[model samples]
Target: MSRLATSVTAALVVAIVTSWTTVVGDARADTARTQPCTRYTAILAPGTWETHIDADPAVPVGMLRPLGDGLQWQFGRDITVLYAPYAASAFDQGLTYAESLSTLEATLHHMVATLCGSTRVVLAGYSQGADGIGDLATEIGNGAGPISADRVVGVGLLADPHRDPDTTLSLGNPQPGDGIAGARSQDFGALTERVRTLCADGDLYCSLNATASPFLSALGKVLSGDPAPIAYLIPAYTDPGTLIEQAVTVGAGWAATAANLPTILEGLDTLPRLLTSGDIAAAHQIASGLNAALSPMVQAAASVDLTLVASVIRAAAAVDPSGWTSAASVIADALAYVDIQRIAFTAGHIQETLWRTMESLTRNDHLQAAAELAVLTPSVFDLADATLGPLLTAVRGDLALAVDTLLDIGGPESIDELVQLARQGAALASFYGSNAHIDYAEDVQTLLGFLRTQVAS
Candidate 1:
């Protein structure tokens, strides 16, 4: 599915970037306080993504919300979460992936150098931010950073929505892989378990795409939205003390590179109509002719400009004593979902892997990390010895394949005709024996509902 801001304009992007939340008290200042760890939760938003991370500056993100109510409890402790935006690398306005990411790296590097490095951190993100966090986590987990995974104590992630899923009609109707199919709560667990002492879990955003099948994509969690880096909220100045020009440059890049987002959405809208037609074989003809799972979703959830979300928050920040009234309800339920799934994915497997990763955590820096890594960590690493390293090495291929499947199948046209496509998935699974995309059908339905809320809201 095209999980991005379909209509986000460049101008809006320049208006929303913003800050950090650091708690100065000791860890024991208040067992009830989520801020005692000297925290920095920075959000990076997309020009058209959801408003995650710090919904409102004064309010703590996730579990740290000021009101006792907005707090998310896990093992009875509040987790300090940060969201960093990832600008699209292909913005038409003179931006590229290398440059956008470089901007993020510099900011994160600063955060680590100035504050985050001293204590444990719970780096969190969605969409592009998710990708960045994973990349960042790997660097930190593999080498040196302010806080190591072992020291981090926890990592919470939402739908990373980076892969593709099958879009055959057979996988329609929430049978499986509702949103971002291949991305299981368990998958993210493996990625983050090494960081926190506790079990890790993530929110999945899988949705039903056209192609009309009842089975779900094995890889569907692709629509997770974006959050921007905190830096963009307050507008910055160039060397001459003027506004930075590339702020909107990234948006232009997206218009050029991922411009297909609107087309994808429009194409999928036809699936329901196609499935409703009376001819099953004709529908099958349509289904059999296409390979939806091969396409997958695209774009950086970091597509939305954080500046826009910040503008919304700035307007509403002082409206009431509580930030977002509904945040309490949303966070509580979501946390419950994440915590339960974390246990299921780990099933005690994570604890063992954690021990293995640590042995090499401080060692294999030169091989696994960027050239500058050894200088960042305490210097003693070796991933080869870590049991979970093998799984991580394998993750890239699995996820890459998953991405292709989602983009190929989900689109406005594909969505209009899912039932027959879902039936096709059943046929494929029965004959081909359940490929990666087959499992996401059911979950896609769930994702549709969730995604609609995040943006249409």
Candidate 2:
């Protein structure tokens, strides 16, 4: 079955790439480049969506606009924006990710060929765009891409899905692995000094752990019935950065889930049963379907109870510890309890379930979490203790605060309080997950300092 799955995945990847390649062929010419060779500093912002363009300086879009505007204001030279049009669609991350890979590469190739001699390029991107820009940075750092390392001032990535914990690219908190899509072929071993990677706490795309991401990758494959997307996770698991990245991603995922209290509750309700079930694959499929139904914006957000799922799954497998020939099978069996047919993936169902689940998770003073923890098998508790016990304890206070705020907002309450809760949740998530990426003002200033030093040199 795995072999058949692999072959199917390969075929799907080839087809997706072939079709997207056709669309991207002509689009490469659209990689907007600035001219007149004025030695102006350049900021390339590949907006998360394909709609962003470089045509209007008056209109602000993406991370580059404000930063570029500031640089222009300070130096009196307009900053150039490199625009690459790629499908930054949601849910269909695999397709958009592939498009970004190709389009951004071509775009950078052109920019370097035309402007590198006279321009000092500073690259930045957000979300999917960040993934592409990070890849480009890796290539340049490795001396394998179009632009020479010296000609590039620095690179900044926001919520990069390709963030690798092992790379010196990120100066914030430490993680265990690379992005969900995986790490670059070559490490940014060369660009250590020039690269700055910022991944928000709980942004699962960049920070999901190496040990656990395969489950997510497999879950994605089983649910989506496509293999290409799973490809990223395979290589990603091997990257030393995968573990730490997964940790932070998990944190961010929990934060987002908390913000979408309704949606997370739905998953939380079903998670315990699936984790304890004898059939792991079925549990995984059900979990995947439930996850698929989650808001794409919060898809990476796994509820805080996810640690329980991990613990129970591992504990269940320990029963046949000697009987298991391979750990993969153990993991797969752990996911074998969920029935997709019984599950609902519709937006309406998700919304309804979100509200229902929120009520269940929070009512009785959020005793559900305590109940789940109490019922865990000793082995499972041990597993949780070894893995996420400390993390959960550390974040418990914030989680309580968030739950309280959420409950208050669920009633007829002030929008101000709700907004305040949102802010608190975001801050807590960052604290738990290493969302240092939010410090953009400081990051940009740091970048400006680097550019100044580089130009002076």
Candidate 3:
């Protein structure tokens, strides 16, 4: 279906579901239980990837332990850890995210149904688990979930991939658009004051700047086979001529120093990769088939400017080697030139790269692998609850074949390698990692304090 038709159909389905939820909620007037709970607080944590309930919360030492352990220290028997489990593997993220969300909804309903009226629930999660909790919070805040917004004493989501831009209560800069999977169709205005989205700088999953856009757009295109939204972004980006014009307009007499050449070249090399590295697969796959589709236009628009930019930088570096600040200035000028274009081409590059990659994948007859990933596109409608459920279940079989295909798509040697790379780069570097994917020790303390105030006993 065309993007427009698909979008319209999805919207109609959401409208129907919204009406159904409202009617069901009205018929069940008694949403909360009458019995008073002996305990004041209950904590629920979802496992990042699991098909069943987790035995324990997956947190690093001295991280979120303070909340649970501290609460136990205050009231030993009052604290209960409810580990929310679901299929959290990368390949099944779409399925597990939905299934775990439903499981959490059912669990919350049961808790409110049987627990004491005064009980306050504290929700916390990390990574995929964070996405599930954040999504649930969005649902409750919007008055569509099983639980009431008031019952939520505190919510702590570490590295939540679905984090919305201005609404986050946590520290860190705001990102463009929304999370990697994009924002919920509705707002969480109900929990606006209570929810916190903590993200460190350079976490691509939350931010849409230089590092995130290319990868996200690429992933989006591969999964959806649509790129026009991102493709049209080419003109919006700074052209090489614009940067050169700006530099010459400054007309500051800055000559290069021998000491600065290495740094300048390094920065130039790193800058291009930084802005464009997200197209790893695209770089490899573009030649496979996209030549007939996108190459001509891309070449016509980019060839002269690219060559001009490269020539200017090389010439600038070769001019003079005596002025100390001149070399540094040249480097700075080059960096500034690259930054704007980097931001601009991110979306377009992602589209081009993913389109090429898809073409190659199909030609290679990696049909099942391609099909498995095709269903993971971000949508306002619930794909898991829809007809896609059976496919999700069936794909779990033939584990070896599925894993191989997914690994290639992700550009990782193995799952372990990807995990290691993520851990190393998530908070500091610009590789494929999210701000919401790190170990949030400080946030745990904040969560504990927030819960303490809400459940004053």
**Would you list the C-alpha lDDT of every candidate in the order shown?**
0.30, 0.46, 0.42
User: Per-residue lDDT tens digits of candidate 1, residues 1-457?
Assistant: 0113312422223222223222321221233244455432322222112333223322333221211122223212323333332343323223322234444444455444444444544454334444455456656665554445454433322333432233212212323333432322223323333321110122222223323322222112111222132222322221100111111122222222122323422322332244344232332333222212112111111333333322322322222122221121121121211222222222223223323333344575424323332222211112111212432343334432322333355544432332232243333334333233223222323332332232222
lDDT of 2 at 90: 31
Error of 3 at 53 (Å): 3.4
How many clashing residue pairs appear in each of the predictions shown? 157, 44, 5
Off by over 4 Å in 1: 1-106, 144-147, 162-457
Q: Residues 1-457, candidate 3, lDDT per residue (tens digit)? A: 2455434433543453344334533232234233234465554554444334322332322234566676656666665544443334331322213333444444444434444555667776665566667767777888876577887766776656666666777644444545555555666768777777665454445554323232232232122122222222212223322333322222121111111223323432332343245343533343222222222223223323433333333334332232212332332333323322232243244444445545656677466434523432221012112212432343333323423443564446443332221222232333332334454566666666766665664
**lDDT tens digits, residues 1-457, model 2?**
2445545544664554455445453344344333355465554555445333223323446555565566556666535554444444332343323433554455445445555366677676666667667777788888887777877777777667667666655644545555655555566757767777766555555565544334333221122222243333332112222322333343333334334434334544555565565333443444454454334224332332234333322332232222211232222222222221222233333334334434545564346533443433332333223323443444444544544543553444432232332343343355445644443555555555655454445
Name the lDDT of candidate 2. 0.46
Instruction: Give TM-scores for every candidate, taking all chains together and pairing residue i with residue i.
Output: 0.29, 0.47, 0.42
| Cα RMSD of predicted structure 1 | 28.2
Candidate 1 residue 288 C-alpha distance from true site, Å: 24
